[model samples]
Each structure stands twice: as C-alpha cells, then as structure tokens.
Target: MMRLVASDIDGTILGHDGRISARTVRAFQACADAGVEVVFVTGRPPRWLYPLREQLGHSGTVICSNGAVLWDLAEDRLLSARAIGLEAVLEARRLIKQLCPDALFAAETVAGFHLEPGFIENPTSELLAEFTPAPLHETLTAEDAVVKFLAVTHSGTPDAFLAQVQPVVAHLVETTHSAPRTALLEMSAPGVNKAVTLAAYAASLGIEAADVVAFGDMPNDIEMLRWAGHGYAMASGHPEALTAAGYQAPHFDDDGVAQVIEARLAEEKLGA
Candidate 1:
C-alpha cells in the first residue's frame, strides 16, 4: 500500500489558473484523512510555496528548490537547507558564461531571489512580486549561499541548451529543466534532485520507495518519478518524465492527479 504521495506543483497539481481546484483539494484532504503523508516536491522556491501552503491548509513538508530545502509548511519555517558551495557556484557560472554568453542567470539565495534583468519568471510564480534585481556579477559574488541557479535563454529551446552545457558541466553540477517548453534550465549541487531529498524524508518516516507514489510532468521530476515505485507521468508530460515514469495519468488541467489520488483512496477503502 502506498503510504506517501510526492507531487510536482506547477503541472502535476495546479490548474491552468495557477490555483488548486476543489477536486484536487479534496484529494489532498483525503490523503491526510487517511494518514498518508503528502509532500509537494517541485522546482519551485520556498517563497512560491506560500499559496500552496494555504491551499493545503499548511500541514506538511515541502521539498523545495528541487530538493535543496525542506520546509515545514505548517509551521511556516525552514527545517533544513543544502546550498551549493561558493567554489562550485563560481565555477558553474564561469563555465556557462564561456559556453553560452547570452544566457540570463538567476540564483536562489537563502534569503530570496537574486536575478538579472534578462531573467523571466514563470507566469505562475509568486516570488517575483517581491524579488530584488541585482547585476549578474554582483549576484554571483554574494557572500550568501545559493540553493539553486537558473539559466534562462532569450532564444533557443531548453533541450538545445541542456545538450550544449551537459558535457561541459554535468560532472561539475547537476542540471535539468523545470519548464518543458521554455529555455529555463535549473541547476543544483552535485547529486541533488527531488529523489534524493524525498527518499531521505521517506526513510525518516519508515516508508520505503515501494510505498511511495509520485507524479510529475517535467525533466526535473524524472529522478523522483524513477525513484518512486509507482510513478505516474502526466499525459502532457515532458519526454524525459514520460520515459522515466512507470505509468501514465491524465493531463493536469483535466485533474489527472486528483483522478489518481481518489482512485488510490478508494482502493485503500476496499483493501485492494
């Protein structure tokens, strides 16, 4: 029986209007009512998770920044943070500049976002409402630790960008795309991903990989999906996620996650 539900936020659960539907909300409530731990695992930063916290009634752990931080949403406190070392951050910035000169960059510092003018926010992001813009040079030289770095392109696809930078920096840092269509590429420290943090959280709760069910629609979710025993890729999911998941669910706008969650709840009720 599944004991945990790890879900990606932007595409896996939220509706097109960037809010939770009643159906999805009910699914989460059912999970809680059934004593199953619910985790929002995503590439979204902590600031962006506030609305979600309110939607879920602020009662669970959120693995944010693609696994760089674990937040106790109910208490509205940060439990732990894993930042990329200064040396690695500098090295990755240097390599990206040399290979992709025109790429715009942003870093998620412990406090908040330090972004350049060229960087664009996802239409669904709430963090930008209070973010501060800094020069790329100034941002990269900050004394604060960086949780994640984003490379955004004014032109070109994320796949092309990923291919161009993988060989040069993959060994030095971890890289993946959160948004499938945009040229937004996300980077975390070596060996960091949703899977790493989620697995650790599960172990702490005495839940194994076989007892977790995860959902996603982007490349960043690929690792987490693969790590879960029953990974469901959205019908409109990215190619990488589709390849990584063991099964397929309906589309996000169609309440695909709710469909799956409600089904699981029913099975539990029936002892199936």
Candidate 2:
C-alpha cells in the first residue's frame, strides 16, 4: 500500500485552467486526514506556490524547481534547495541566445524570476496568465543567485536546444518539457531531480520511495513517478510520462488525482 502521494500541478493535479477541482480538494483533505503525504512536486518556484500552499493542509513538503528546492510549506522555510552555479547560469544564457534566438528566457531566483525581452510572450495558455514577467538583468543578475533557467521557445527548438546544451552542460541540468512546445530546464547540483529531492526528503523521515505512489502528466514528473513504488500516469499525460508509469489515472479535467488517491487509500485500508 502507498503512504505517500506526489503529483504534478499543471496537467495532473490542477484542472487545465490551473485550479484544483472541489472534488480534488476534498480528496486531498481526506489524504491528509488519513496521514497520507500529498506532496506537490513541480517545476515552479516558491512564490508561485504561495497562493496554494495554505490549502494543502497537512500534505507533505513541496518539491519545487524540478526538485532543486524542497520547501517545508507548513514551517514557512526552505528545507533544502540546490542552486545552479553562477557560471552555468551564464553559459545557459548564452546557449539560449544562440539556439532559440527568438526564445524567451529567464532565471529563477529565491527573490523571484527575471525574464528576457519577448521571452514570455508565448507562454502556454495556463502559464501566460499566472506568471509575472520582468526584464532579466533588471530583476536578476550575476550578483543575484538563481536556481535554474526557465526557457520558453517554439516547439521546434526544444529538441535542438537539448541536443546542444546537454553535452556541455549536461552535468548541470535535468531538462523537462512542460508545455507541449516549451521546455523548462532546471539546473541544480549535479544529478538533481524530483526523484532525488523526494528521496532525500523521504530519507530525512525514515521513509522509502517504495512506500510512495506518485501521479503525474508531464515529462518532469516521469522521474518522480518512476522513483515511486507505484507510479501512476494521468491518462492525458504526455507520451513519455505515460510510458513511464505503472498505472493510469483519469485526466486532470476528470479529477484524476483524487481518483488515484482514493483507490490507493482504499488499498492501504485493506492491507492494514
């Protein structure tokens, strides 16, 4: 039986418009009541999470920035966060400039995210409205440390950019596509990802990934799902993520997260 449940936000937990359904919210509350950990693991920053953290109740810690940052939402503190090194940020800036010359690029920092001109002009429908955009150097600089680079490019460039950036900066990143046409490449300490972050979090509590059941619907969530003992891919998940999971949950629009969580909770009760 699963004791922990980690889910992606954009296309897994959140409805397409970015809000969790009333049904999902109720399910989460029950998960908390049952002492099951419902960790929200995503590629977003803390500020983005600020609005939703209060609703999570007794859910587990947030695994943010593709796992570069582990935020203890209840405690209002950062339990762990691995920042991208300065030089790598610079190199990444240059790489984005070269590959997606017209792409929108920015760096994510503890303070907030900074954007380059025209970088966010074409965000995914869901993201276009939520994020605040600002000039990169104006908001963040070499002096202001960043956790990762969030790049927005036409669908055509993601594969090309990865091919080019991986060989040189592969050691610095774990790139995952969020929007069908965009990539959110996070740079952290070598070998960091949602999986590694959750592993560390679990170890801190004497828990194991095998006791976890993760659900997701995007590329970044693949590793998190694979790391869990019982991995569930949302029925509407991207192809790669779908292929990585052990089971399928309903799509986000249909309350997939809750359905999966409910089933697992029942399984746990039977086992107990």
Candidate 3:
C-alpha cells in the first residue's frame, strides 16, 4: 500500500493562474484523511510558501528549495536546511563566470531573496519590495547559510544554457531548472537534489521508496520521480520529466495529479 504522496507544486498541481484547483485540494485532504503523508516538494523558497498555506489547508511539511530546506507549514518554521558553503558558492560563481560573463547572480537564504543589480529586469512591485538588491558577495557573508544559488542570462534558451553550464559546474554543484524557456539555472550543494532529501525524509518515517507515489513536471523533479516507486509525469511536462517518470498522467491544467490520486484512493478502498 502507498504510504506517501510526494508532488511538485508549480507545474504539477498549481495552475498558471497561481491557484490550486478544488479537485486537487480535495484529493490532497483525502490523502491525509486516509492516513497517507502528502508532501509538497518544490524549488520555491520558504518565503514564497505563505500564500499556499491557506490553499493547501493543512500544516504539513514542504520540501522547498529543491530539497535544500524542509519547512513545517503549520508552524511557519524551518525544520532543517542543507546549505552551500560560502567558498563553494564563490567557486561555482567563478566557474560559471568564466563560461558566461553576462550571467547575473542571486542567492536565496533562510532570511530572504538577495540579488545583484540587474539580475532580473522589470521586477514586479512585489518583487522590488520583497527582494533585497545588493552585490551578492556583499549580501552573503561567511556566516550566512545559502540555500540555493541562481544564475540567469539572456544569451540562450533555458535548455541550451543549462547544457553549456552543467558540464562546467557539475563538479562543484547540482544544477537544474524548472522553467523550460526561462534562461535560469538553480544550484544547490553538490549531491543535494530532491531524491536524496526525499529518501532521507521518508526513511525517518519508516517509509520506503516503493511505498511512495510521486508526481512532477520539470527537470528539477527528475531525481525524485525516479526515486519513487510510482512516479507520474504530467502529460504537459518537460520532455526530461516525461522520460524520467515510469507513468504519465493528464495535463496539469486538467487536474492530472488529482485524477491519479482519486483513482488510487478508489483502488485502495475497493481492495479493503
């Protein structure tokens, strides 16, 4: 029997309009009521999760920052974090700069998002209000724990950019991107990705990968998808995710994740 349901938030469950469908919400609550653990695993920073607190309606654990941080949603507290050391961050930056001098940098920490000037253009008023603009090196001190590092460039498509940088930085950090067309790359500490953290978390609960059902729609979700026993890729998901997952679900816009969850619950009920 499945004991855990791990899902990616953005393209897997969350709609383009930034809302979770009623069907999806009910499916998640049903999992909880059935004594199954539902985990929202995403590349989002901890600060961006508050808006989702009410939407999800349960104070469960969120594996954010591509598995760099574990957040307790109910208490609005950080449970644990796997941060990139300052030297590693600087080294990776140096390596990437050598490959793409036009690359802009940003860092996410437990405190908030910090970016260098011009890292993002036409910043929304909300972003301008929330994000601190300062030189990344100056803003991130040796004492601060960096959760994730971001690099963006207007030079190439997101895939091409990742291809160019992955080889250069592979020895230094784990690199991936969620947005298919956006020329951005997200990096965490070496060997730190969704699967590694998710496995550890599940083990703590005495749950094995074979007892978990995972869903995702992006390259960032590949590791976790492959790690879970039953992994479903959204029909509209990136090519990499489709190839990584063993099964495919309907499109996210069509409530794909919810459809699968409801079907599984029905199967379980019938078997019982």
lDDT (0 to 1) per candidate = 0.85, 0.72, 0.90
Model 2 alpha-carbon miss at residue 14, Å: 0.6
User: What is the per-residue lDDT of model 1 for residues 1-272, given as tens digits with 9 covering 90 to 100?
Assistant: 98999999887887557688889999988998899988899888877786686776756799999999998877878898888877777777789889889877888977877887757656445445677666757756547778898888777888899888877888667999877678888899889999999999999999999999999999999999999999999998888899999989898878899999999889989995
Candidate 1 Cα misplacement greater than 4 A, ranges: 121-129, 140-142
Query: TM-score of the candidate numbered 3?
Result: 0.97
Query: Model 1: which residue pairs collide?
Result: none
- Model 2's TM-score against the true structure: 0.85
Q: Please report how far candidate 3 places residue 3 from its true position, in Å.
A: 0.8
Q: In model 3, which runs have C-alpha deviations exceeding 4 angstroms?
A: none
Compute each candidate's TM-score over C-alphas: 0.93, 0.85, 0.97
lDDT by residue for model 2 over 119-196, one digit each (tens)?
655666445465566666556656765776776655564555555556665655556556655554545556778888
Candidate with better lDDT, 1 vs 2: 1
Worst 10 residues of 2 by lDDT: 51-60
TM-score: the better of candidates 2 and 3:
3
